[model samples]
Target: MKKHNFSAGPSILPQEVFEKSAQAILDFNGSGLSILEISHRSKDFVAVMDEARALVLELMGLTGKGYHAIFLGGGASLEFARVPYNLLKEGGKAAYLDTGTWAAAAIKEAKFFGQTEVIASSKADNYSYIPKGYTIPADADYFHYTSNNTIFGTQMQQFPDTDVPLVCDMSSDIFSRQLDFSKFGIIYAGAQKNMGPAGATLLVIKEELLGKTGRAIPSMLDYKQHIDKESMYNTPPVFAVYTSYLTLQWLKNNGGIAAAEAKNNAKAELLYNEIDRNPLFVGTAKTEDRSKMNVCFLLKDEAHTEQFDKLWKAAGISGLPGHRSVGGYRASIYNAMPIESVQVLVDAMQELEKSIQ
Candidate 1:
């Protein structure tokens, strides 16, 4: 049975990407050296890094717009601190929207760097809905938010437009949709989710936004240093960056972000429609805020949980379990997940409902 992958992070990637990466591991570009053993300073690997950075800018519509893309060794969690370290100035206040777990974590890290204020939050409701109608402080040095909440299954439908510099951690939803990249001063994402395997983080920073923080940033955490060195200031994550490059190539071949969003919406709809229709199931997030990438749901009747679990398992499903903190089910329908796999999941849900009825 072919397994349907729905893992949250280090998730599914295009089959073609996997095949190409495997071949490159053995002998990269006919150079007779494994991608693993290849030198980071090599001309061949430099080409890969350059292409990956260029592709990220192109896909986000930031090409030649004073935006520099860099891949780093740390994940998005590290970026939570790095963002404030490089942007939140001393004695200046930073505003954040607390939509879910990651957003809360970002707020926690920002406090260490400066005066951090949570302008809005939906944690009171277990983060089922995205907060709205809250005022962002005009005097804030910058505003930070997570574009998608993987654990809570909520995504901000639209970004807040504020004079304060906008920074985002798009770890779970980057490249999953089309966006006006010009609106954000900075955007960072972990490559594991929609981009590629774990190990590298993608950062798209506006050139003019650096040096305003007035703090002595560590070498690795400084965006200007990474940009000046062309993402080669230190030994980069070679394997992860290469895989991400392949994935970006795949996205470009598949018609870029717009095409991915169409498929992602379709897959989310297929499963969410079932969750709403089936009397045995119900979605976790509010209808309007439901995440297209991570769809969290639960069985309506707790007694039937085991039956539903076995139903999906028997149908070759994997990673349907929710985060441990939230005991439910989360179906992560990323860019690489096909609509057919979603239909299979929907069919399994329908079959289980029928059996119970």
Candidate 2:
């Protein structure tokens, strides 16, 4: 049976990315060597790294705008610490908005460096909605927030208008939609969700934001060091960087972020409409805050769990279960997920309602 994938991370990628990545693994660029064996400093891999960084800035519309893009190891979790380490000065404050797991994790790390203030949060409501009307301390070094909450199925539809440097973790939603990329001082994302695979993380930083923290940042955690070395500060994740480059090429060929946003919006509407219309189902996140990337919902009656599970699975669906923290189902329709696959899940929902009636 043909499978429809909906896993949240290390998740679905363009079919061409899989094919090309596999080809590179066997005989990278016809160089007679596996991508796994290439030297990070080799000419071929260097080209890959260069193009990937440039493509990231291009796709984000940040090129020639004093922004630098770098692919790093240690995933985005590492960035939770590195961000504050390089940006928050000793005894200076940092501001954050806690909307989900990752945002809270970032706040924890920032606190270690200096005073970390959570100016707004939806944690009291189980992170089902985005907090509003919060004040960002103007004297703080930066303000950080997560763009999408994969586990809780919530997304921020708009960003705060603050003169404070805007730092965002766009892990699950990066490149899936269009945005004013210049508005952010820093944007970081784990590659597993929408960019590529799990081994690499992408960080785009405004050059001027660095060298202002007034603390001795470890070379590994310093963004300026990586930028100075052109993202080759140390050995990089070669395979992940190449695959991410391929994915970025794919995005550009398909009309860039504008086109991807349209498809993503369509997929979310199809699933959310069914969840709201189906008498046997209900959505988990607030209707206004529902994520376009991850659609989380549940059966109106717990008695129907087994039946719904069987229906989706039997129809060749996989990764339909929600995160343990938010039980029920989550259909992650990322940039690469076709509308046709969404229809399949919607059909399963309709089938459940029919049987229950």
Candidate 2 per-residue lDDT, tens place, 187-218, comes to: 99999989899999999999999998878888
Each prediction's whole-model lDDT (CA): 0.92, 0.93
Full-model lDDT, candidate 2: 0.93
User: Candidate 1 on 1-357: residue-level lDDT in tens?
Assistant: 999999998899999999999999999999999999999999999999999999999999999999999999889999999999998888899999999899999999988988999988898899999999999899998899999999999998988877888999999999999989999999999999999899999999998888998889889888889999999999999999999999999999999999999999889878888899998888989999999999999887899888888998999999999998667899888999988888889989999988977
Q: Give the range where candidate 1 is weakest over 10 consecutive residues by summed lDDT.
A: 324-333
How big is the positional error of residue 36 in model 2, measured in Å on the Cα after superposition?
A: 0.7
- Tell me each candidate's TM-score: 0.99, 0.99
Cα-lDDT of candidate 1: 0.92
- Per model, state how many residue pairs clash: 0, 0
> Which ranges in model 1 have alpha carbons more than 4 Å from their true place?
none
